[model samples]
Target: MRRLHTRTARRRVVGALTAGLLCTFGPAAPALAAPAPTVAAPAAADVAPTVDDGLALTPPMGFNNWNSTHCRAEFNEDMVKGIADIFVEKGLKDAGYQYVNLDDCWALQSRDANGKLVPDPVRFPNGIKAVADYVHSRGLKLGIYTSAGTKTCNEAGFPGALGHEYSDAQQFADWGVDYLKYDNCNNQGVDARLRYTTMRDALLAATGTTGRPIVYSLCEWGQNKPWEWASDVGHLWRTTGDISDNWGSMLSILKQNLPLAQYAGPGHWNDPDMLEVGNGGMTDTEYRSHFSMWSIMAAPLLIGSDLRDASDATFDILGNKEVIAVDQDPLGKQGTVLSSEGGRWVVAKEMKDGSRTVALFNETGSAQRVATTARAAGLPAAGAYTVRDLWQHKSYNTAGTISATVPAHGTVLVRVSTDAKWAKNPPAVELGLDGGLLVEAGKPVKLTSTVTDLGRTAAAQVSVKLSGPAGWAVKATSPAGTHTLPTGRSLRTTWQVTAPKGTPADSYDLTLKASYRSPTGVRAENVLPLTASVVVAPPAGVSSLGDLPWLSTTNGWGPVERNTSNGENEAGDGNPMTVNGVVYAKGLGVHADSSVEYYTGKACETVTAQVGVDDEEGDDGSVAFEIWADGTKMAASGVLSNAQAAQAISADVRGAQTVRLVVTDGGDGSTSDHGDWADAQLTC
Candidate 1:
């Protein structure tokens, strides 16, 4: 399953721009700093006819074993059957998931005497047809994988369908295969379209003989701009490379796929690879965003995690029916960018019932308010509209505003419509802070929160309460309870909030909860979180960053460690911070797609660190280290691998409010990508 895990350099295409998609879906967000990918359009006469077998009316949702098991011994007939059983027992089948697809390494390295592909006897003792029969018995379809080249992507080098497409296709049809994931690997330098189209024609012929139509999926990694010509060739074509279980990989793939919304429809789709939820490489918040954005883009939603040991949180994300509805909408229209600025993105998708699914995405490192209007979301002008928060499972009425305070790498998905049934739902109340709170330990700060009724109906028994951590005192300065709040009216409450003495200088969450009831007496509650900083100014002279408190820290796989290497995806699980055989006494160890921010207080003059891929991962890790001072990139270590020695980097932080250290995957999947900032220090 090398094609499913390995990532190569992105091919820069120089061809015709999708002007129609840009005009219809809006332009790419400048804040992402990614240019739209271009492709050359072929002449009408030469374009291959797309598959029209009436399959994949919606982007296929299923489970693939490659991401979790790869080529491990666990990927056998029992594993496949167990997953199908989970689909039926755990509500996945009822959630609209159908196909149970297997990736590479499912076949023997050598074919049989008849030149037909053979399932690995040890992995599938019952043979391919028996396993397919078991899956079909569960009322689910089964899919198989192979390469268009001479050999598959696995290290075993299984035989591919390059010259034996008809024979392999006939074999798969005979085995009752319902889907095929055709990969690009070891192709012997053949043209991409020709190889994929040949298989498409072979599958058609085999289907014509057996009357079993198999869904065709092309995994070419977007080298040839498949979207421009593969519409009639395959049911779905990958628009980018494989996705890693990290934020940077997910975000990068999203940016690449976001610009190609116009090419997606009922029968054809733009595949951005499989889902990476519950892989322990990211937080639950990030996973939700990953799921939401994929659904919004109308990409295939293949579960990449092993379901046998999935956590409840993972199941909650994968089992959200409302979010799945957006992906399966009969309209088959993909979501497009409405606006993107400063790491805040607003994407909207038109549904079949005159509704729009809007996703407020925050790509920044901190929580921020992201907002858009109904008109901007492509909703018709109305005096009042309904906004349903898909994740929160709450409905609110809005005059037109669709906004939320989204966490870092988080998404707030909502459906906006003029449906009248939403009026019976709870009144939409939102909590907002008047200004930023920066307080000292043991000092009381006056924090004000404004509660607004955005719903169509008035709210009764509206009470606002402010809560904080233990040892912190909270006293209301204004009336905490309001008898009634009319529509469009707001109630402001000031709170005397204090942090406990000896509190560390870090970001803390202060919540403002508003409890109210609709005119019909339905109880409703809204909780808004505010991130306040407890500052302890650094002393004069140079200080080690490990000794100082950081404003915030996020890591790809594990908790950012001080004076250690990121040993595993857990807190307090790390070795001494070592880079290229050098042990560091103090610094930060993190994984790729990780960031650590310090409150410089506009006092630090310079920040320095010795950065590289940690030696714990041997010579396999690849990463890029960057230093940002107040949103300005001051220094960068371009693509440092574990094979290289550590490089010293310094960034001028004079007069900057915050200093952020970032490490990203170096054009590869973030497997074993352990990054270290050795001897990190700040000078004031």
Candidate 2:
């Protein structure tokens, strides 16, 4: 029960790491049970025209219930209807939102006697068709979810469209379904493109009396390189794993999706997952960035929140017509990063109407001021241009140079167009790095990047350098040596980056500085900061944890200290209760709820950690420490009052996972209950 039913696995599978910073557990990676079927290649001849149903020509816009009300369990029909009502009654339709997509778990435990998928009667007594009628009546489209495999991602308690693709497609079209979000899960060993096209064929073959055109959305989580071949198969395709509502995850998705812009155009888009605005994980600034970036990417603007109870801020952010217009821009050209400096990004898109859309994005921790000339952003630099902040709904004047101080994780989205219709030639050279952003703590990963000249002019003296965590032994071939790149040419370079022996499971930024000279002999630089997340998996057998930069992302009262004594933790300082070795937790009075997280490479039969009060305990208080695994508290040190002896707490962590060590003040007003989780070790 400590699995999918409780937590959502948005990252890697269960027995693997329910990653994305410990979201939850899923089934172990599915096995290839048998020889894969000799699936035929995609029907190149028919695939294009079959799904090119003149629909979703501008990136399907809607609200999907899967991300927010995952199986609301009670009255799923009303839930969807409420959103559809909100879309029309609240002006969302006017803003170009047109779809209200429903997800899995809306199915019954059993299909009809004829093996037809049925809506769970208790959840949708009126049936899905009734809800579809309502949504369509409001001039909106209706989308439903299913899986290409045997079951849905949630292993939903119902059959998917795998074996009954024709029947399900017929039923969906008959019921007026307009969109289909096909997930990949529980598939035996069928090739992804094969399975998805099977359903695509199923939907296309459904004609006659129940025949209706449906937009196809492939949600295979991008592991299969969908962009390489999903051109005519679906209206949109997911380009990465799911997105969590946090600054780190959102920024990571932005970086991942930036390079996939080429695959998006008129009939199809590269979805970066759903929007998490007003979800309360990050600040409004971060949500603004998320919304702006998604719009810039031309991604499907699917709201992942309950609109019935949406805050005014959420409503405004989602209903921002100006930003939505940029996403719905008829030009259909997806935005790409124009230039990057550290964590700041300048994204630009060419509009079909001779105008250009630009966004100054900052993902740093504080406000940063970045500047660029109009020519650098591909705009005509003849005279002053009109710049309007889509989020602020205000206009500003800028002549050639456009500058703004953007808050951390915030965006300055604007449209820059002057009277002169001549836009500057594009950048002469662009730099891109390809490698696994997530690195194993002690392993080394070689990175490769390609420098291309997209403009007509040639570039010379091209050079590239990398800056990462100090002393990671990061080395790269000196692209910095003088070199010439002709127009339409590209140069590739490799960099070998090795993580330190004792790196922690956290995200690190690696900044790439690439400089070149234009045809006119002017120098230009593009700073691309790549985020490398380190996963420190516990080694085999039993081993002592080594020294790492231990800082808590969420602060409680005190800090998790190492061999050095923690003096100021308590009022007088200087008493880190290190029991047997180097690691422990210390706190201040009246509080101290801190936790330490680690990744064990393999399954561990047992884990042990010593707990004790700080050696400098002065008053009467109780300290309680606990060890948690798979979302369950496995062991505890009850309530220790004295600081003399260390108590041993052990837990059976039979699988490789993220183990958490938590220390608290025993529920009472923390007096001198400075607690410590000392010398934690794992036995595999």
Candidate 3:
């Protein structure tokens, strides 16, 4: 059965120019002292341009076609023209959307005679340059798609960037491609950084000859934290699995991108894939929440819905200026969940202006009043502030604390700013298990503490204190904060603890005390509670008799099946046979008679046998057994009497210490039944 690899919608944004080049460019205005563009030059050294360079250029915002087109790969001139016209007509370019991208399946199976990559004749009869020209005419940039692996999503079977990175890159550049979405499929086990770098270098090489800046979009599916390394290679790297139209899939994908806030900035970002905003899987409220969250995450605002006939609601979601501002904010700090209560989640992002943006989301199935507080977000004491609802376009001067009723599977985003005297100290210490709370005895447990510096950088010192029953002992302790815990950095320590021999299965608590020097040089204390548990030991051994390791010999006889055949056959005539042995009243008893069928010159003959037991290790004797057929005992002492005709055998004995079965050939040594034993059994 074929299974689909779930794709995450996010893409990694590589270096500044590399990053900017990957995004859609609105009509270029006069240069505003922008950083020198670090065009990727195809040098033989194989060195990568820094991520700083990629993020310094275009900061990635555009429209993608997948969510709108779905699996329909017939991207004809009319389709391209229609979408490009809408982008210009809707004023989306002025709203910060510039790239009109075509997703997978647009390529023909083979390249042209000129050795240039070929677009499908049926889909692009007028050629890619025509499409590029039209999109450019609309003052918008054009992006194309390809696979890093050997096949495109369309399965049209085009040559991938596997070994021909340079050629493929040149081909795209020669086609006047402004953006390249290099997908990861069919390319298994390739080093992510190297895989992406190869393409980035190729694009640079291609762009060098073409003298046009083509944005490199790395779509490795965030196998590695491309955000951390993608800035050096491409414009955007997907951060999660591909998104479905369903809200569950969308919210789940959004939640996964929360921890990656530190890596986003101008020109580089965590792509949550494309938008499914206009899809019918969710309500308008949910889409608004979706748009709001993506904007706050600094994710690439790639609208995946059809733009030509978007509903008013779709346009409203795409045109939410306040939310868009937060996304395009120069500071580019991604928002993260600060706290959660039931289905209500509170997320926050710190802006460059020293203000904070908070989003209260209700992911549950019903509406919920999400309460917000300064403490939950690691802010200073709560008091007075100015708050604006980004989606509602309304402002209110309220206290430091805020509360709002969020619709089901929806979110309310607010920007908070204040001129009040805020505390410069780190928030109350929060502790976490570096690995996990559960641990095996004698194994080391790593603990971590998050120390936040409200505004000013503060130094934090953390120490763990253990208190348990009399038998419990503290194995070792690392110095307090000897491991530097920078502001917003976590301090970690490994504690080695051993359980006492008689330790019972119970829970034990450990208190972690964290003290810190505030920016004002004042010392304060915060305490965290942690727990650990002990488990029961394994049963005493019966000498190698533990859990049944193999499935074949464990319980009752397994059914004879094609996969595990155990039947007597021509190929396996002399193989050993196994039977369920029964022990009764300290003696061996043959529950059923044993018999073997053998072919003697095309004539079948039946055989019978007798068995006995002998006990040597116990007061009761063991068993010695044997089988006989055609007036001949199979064997008395470790030998088979009938070497040729032997069909089956059985054995029964009592008070015996040990039992041994011997095989004896019959007088007639016929080759047809020369060696065969169908089945055997022993019972006591």
Candidate 4:
């Protein structure tokens, strides 16, 4: 959450005056308030509805006009109709998608003379109601966009439900809107929860009066936990910021929603905003991964692209019935990361059929073999399993456990069932680390192992043993198999080792052995070696100030400054200045001004400085100093004006040891013409 702060109007007046007086004023301005916090309404009453109620409708799937459509020249009725027709013609509707959502930038600037909200006359000449009717005629739902704040992002944007919640809600209902995607922008200084609830209450009131069940879609961008409260006020809340048409953005949004699974149900769900699955910026493999992740997350399947002309690959991905089933599972238990190793990630979802759906996801740039055993997914015990590849629609009967080679940024989803019998086969165990081969000693290391039975019916017994040097000991363990071993069958363990008094510093190898019985009652063993070590070193000193590396120049507006070959120069103009080794400034201008220069052979671990300024004209003249690390500001001095000179301002640089300084000109239009600083210093 971002903090709230007050901006002084005087600074703007001064800057304007200075700009007018000297046509040479540069592009330097004080940092403004951070972006506002986004919040959603309170949770809905915890009453579970029947499967027949609207609440039980299949997680509303549809194409959203945000990622791709936002870049268009306009969002008019033709565009909506074209997208809707494509939804049906492309077999998307058959795949269970029923909505065509229009995101921001579709509204007029004001209300009609009759106090009705109006659509842009030029783009949406027939108004939103006509658009909704057209979409309805195509057997799909229509969603409109609005902001929870004062204005929408489009031109002719009307002040939405902010302050006039009831009026706005009534207008939306009258407009025959089926879905209302309430956004958050321009509504600064308002409590997030209150901001969302204000609109929710108004919408609910209007819904009741108008005899409509407008599916309220909260779009606060997850400033707070909307999954916890959206069900009470809206159907779904975006769990992340608006997604872009790129794999990185999609993956980031998906990863952020993994922790909110427990909040999803039949009607209510976690929304990773919308889908960029078909966007051109991502590869085909990435698109598949996107679909798989979204399905497992129980996120609303809202596609944000030009579906009217999608590629065949897009259709195949979106139409994967087996994968979609996991998303629409009646149990509604969202999947979470069980383990991640060597670019291989294992995620599991509990199904209503007393089984589990596991996905082996390979996020690496290259394809990798990913395997999982029943124990890793919290199954009853190791046993031969009937596994079906959801994507390939293939069934394989052989197994000690389930495993597959996943494609780069791809996933292999399988439904594991024990009740159904299979031919007898030997049990097997595979071991690996979650993060990497290298790990810090004494910390808990998560080991992922899969135990599987060749014959799906027989239970497999499993045990594990750890062997290392005499001084090393296993601290704790979590067993995943049915029977705990003298060592343990768990995937995680902590190790502690103490070297002898005169022992030489070195690395040691430890062997982990896992043994298990196959469904056929056959015994098998697997061994894996892990390495650990300790290094001894002496303390070091900050030889010289030039040895500290500052912030990188790439971070244009960041606090730290880069150093030149021999030593960077430091000035006290638009940039910051370091006095006594301390960097200080009011606002460090990115361009010329007051600045500091330092050379760092290598980046320092930390830097410290004292900053402050004297007030020459009492309350009129104030000074400020700021510390920057690699162009990023680490700290700044509070405005200090009308004080004595030699006042101290301070800041600590944590990561980047070397930095520059910024001094700003502050104070009333009187005594002090600029700010000053003293006693600056950088420490290790």
Candidate 5:
């Protein structure tokens, strides 16, 4: 399934190459399937109990060492103990985190002559029991990993507990192991349920002797529909495959886990793999969204970053107690989707206190206002409801409407309840732009930001200010401050913003902040951030777009390549840019959900390109290409497959300041969706 034990650089490269080869399957089916209909819940008496070991009543919150160190030498007993120490010192333990879990590669290649597992001396010199005792001393639990197959997933092929389930379980019990993350790898054709159940019985028998319950985590990669049968076998079963630390990977896992809410409850969960919060593969905003969605789905909160050297931003995200509370709610209910349309999603989870935590998520490339009423979020009717913004840690009283302008790949999480104390914090303000604004470098543009008071109270000292990066100029054309902003009233402020000449092409944050005082004299503030891209005008004559630098780019795999086809899932691994037996000298090669933008300076007329699934994918891959001018879709290539010829695209870009080349997985998951823009040209 997911092998992460390559010790050498060459082996890592080979692993990437092998993944690329595996992606060369037949064309994927249409991606646009109807969303799963929400199923009504059964009565408490009708529901069957799950692995009732009294462990992991909520999804496990802990640290797993697989995502950061893999099989590196740095992953030793000292590192594990250090993680435990950090858990306590850094307030993670106080934040409800436990279990210092170790993944594979901690065991020896072969068992001893007594048929007992042996810890790697280099990795655990004092042995597994010593590490467990140390973690226990720190008031945390200890978890160890092994596969159900004859060997583990790592390249070293460490001994597994397949035929030795009882013996291994007893050994773990003797070592005071508190959790067992049993994986599926080289399973020897055994049935998943049978194998996992064997471990379940073994653990139970072992607990009979030691009187210590071990939380069982089943990591089978969802190949066998574990959620349908894993409830009685393990505490948490992986609902999808392994997760990588990227936006696309996280989004894919979220999609896979969102619809399986009915299968989760007390003592059992549908895990979408571990958290990649500080893995460095995604931006902080995206990581926040990742953590938010997982908490909404009630998945495990196992930290996957190296705690020994994590950033403060990462800790801030992981340490968000409000978000963690949603995951650890005593009700043990997974969130159900309220609505999801056009990359905007609203999900709500019911808490033990009769409150609902609603998440407004934006999955598109631009900021959009996502809205849902309190009723839609399953909140009861009241005179007014306290809307607690979990991310901003602000509270406001809302009559019914709950909305926010969410940034691209961002989430606005709020808890709706009748709690009166929440009403004392502030008033809710909705922020938005008059329309999409795209400006050329060195050019001044007037943009209007609308601030609407959606709360029950009027706001005094209301002021709106727009700010950009250094070297950029911003001046408000309207009044900078007002005496009072009544409820349901909106105040508009226009600001003239100018990007400095020769500004590099990149996406910059332009924040619109509104500050006011509530009726109770509480200082309330709201900030909405949107991206402003600085674009470069095309040359005087027609030129290959690949020859020009882009404002920004996002690819599903590897780095977007210039003048080459997307090769293996690594940088500089692309082949010659080719499609349908035709080779082009210049263009971009990218994966699905990829977008590359360039400034046109409102001078370019027509943008033309030959687009299709890259020939490297053979007869596989399905994708659609679109040309976007400013914020409008100028042209689109309806779902094209690698089996088809290249499709020509020509979009009118007259009076457009920026142009974007976009590739999407054709209504399906982004598997083998290698797309190319061959001979892309911009006519100025």
Candidate 6:
């Protein structure tokens, strides 16, 4: 049993994903997919893979014992009851702290002769059933932890339920457990799917008509790629190992889970372990960052600290309504990191109310200037926005951009309200360029920019101006052809860009300008002053097919599907379907049991590719491949049994404009499902 409760005593943390993931499915896809799907929002990748319990409409907010009690986590009913007292007394319950979870070490040294887990008699003389009743009296829920493995962490001389799923679950239901935090320790190498499912089924069966269903939390330390399928089994699944009370540990887990946002929905959340606020190891600013990040991600805010003696800063952070509001936003969309620099990061979240939140973080030795525009933070282009600095408790207004100087390890979290009322009449006509641009010097490569009218007023005479390297020619036309936009609608246009033959093998930025006149007579001008990188051949075509914008993916935040992805896959987080950052035609490793579609834009005669399962994670999982052209199945690869080598991929995409690739868990779920779509491309 790996006793994670002793986190403070642990030397190092496990499961920190360093490189970040790109959100679009497949590798190199951008988060902002071709605007509008050009027709409707692209179908979201497979619905959540968890069971439908209708619980966790938003991630739970609560308190857990492990981080605070450590080895003392054993069946100490009084301690739990005391925390329950604090919950009501300290305004936590009113602030939304409900569950009082008893993490590992709560069970007795051994099960009774009938094979039911027993609370330690000495520590819990009143019994767990009584404790549950007491917690209920406080208007709070009760939770307990057990392992799927042979023994729970901190063994404590108890035998795990290894083979006793039904009995234990029935026993807990009878004891009135409102939630179950099932850990993974000493499982004797049993397949995680069976063990977790066994318990899930047991819990379902054990519930009597009057019994409320338990909120199941799977704590396998993210090793089995649970995000791809955890929805059906548990309310929330831990995406990484334990969270320690330190900056690095907290940030590591945060970065790792960012890319898996799309996998979470109502009742299903991506767990990043527990929050370590007020744990005495990190500064208050760091704690705020930890809290804010978790909230923005819509993660369960299970604080693992001594609530009985929490300090003022702790109370201030724990009770911040604005920050918590963002987490509980009805939209339920998890925030993603928009951009990151040396020690600066900008994170953004789109809310249900149509407002957006942007968090600027500085992780350096001193204070630093961090800035971002509404568009860059993933917000719709707005002429002005109402900004509320959450931590500073100040509200202000800004035009387009929000900039601030933040202290080391600190964050400036602001909520920006960009209602249509705030829309700049000429709303710089939202524009974006797509596809991997790797054209040979003398050849002309095509480009497309998605233009949308973000304002309430219709606009006309919209024009897009593009400038390439000197002597280079770039041509662009509006998607609507007439260079106009109907309010709330979008148009996608094409561009033919060519570079001079003498341009050496280097990269240059293609500068663009978008302008339009609002019906109100205001020249709404927006400059995509952003430079588009146009790579000059050679290394750019490492693959036969052009890749999506590296930032796109199944989850936003750009998962570490490629070596270029900002984050790496930490072992304990899950098996890497795509591994070692190998540059596949798509992202790094295909996410286990997940699929991403690429818009071909242009029709192709046929598509052929070299594909393989990820070799880095060994050959434990398998993937089934299928290709669809313009919504028709073109080819299928019966489950590729080995992830260590290449599999030839071919699809009859003749004259089709969109090609989609789907990889499944070869029947056994996603164990070892690392995959790669190498050299994927269209024969234009």
Identify the leading candidate in terms of lDDT: 5
lDDT preference between candidates 1 and 6, better one: 1
Off by over 4 Å in 4: 1-58, 154-158, 341-343, 398-400, 419-684
The lDDT for every candidate, in the order shown, is 0.81, 0.67, 0.54, 0.57, 0.82, 0.65
- Candidate 3, residue 547: the lDDT equals 19
Q: Output the lDDT of residue 82, model 5.
A: 98
Error of 4 at 262 (Å): 2.1
CA lDDT of 421 in candidate 1? Answer: 74
> What is the TM-score of each predicted model, taking all chains together?
0.81, 0.61, 0.55, 0.57, 0.87, 0.57
> How would you order the candidates by TM-score, starting with the best?
5, 1, 2, 4, 6, 3
For candidate 6, give the lDDT of residue 364.
46
Q: Which sections of candidate 1 miss by over 4 Å?
A: 1-48, 434-446, 502-510, 529-540, 543-594, 601-603, 608-657, 662-681
Candidate 2 C-alpha error for residue 180, in Å? 0.4
Q: Which stretches of candidate 6 lie over 4 Å from their true place?
A: 1-50, 73-75, 208-210, 419-684
Model 5: ten consecutive residues of lowest lDDT: 21-30
lDDT of 4 by residue, 272-352 (tens): 777777777677767888888888877778887777667899889988888888888887788878877655888888888
| Model 4: how far residue 121 lies from native, Å | 2.3
Model 6, TM vs. native: 0.57
Report the Cα lDDT for residue 382, model 6: 58
- Please give the distance, in angstroms, between residue 638's alpha carbon in candidate 6 and its true position after superposition: 38
Query: How do these models rank on lDDT, best leading?
Result: 5, 1, 2, 6, 4, 3
- Alpha-carbon RMSD, each predicted model: 8.3, 17.3, 23.9, 14.3, 7.0, 16.3
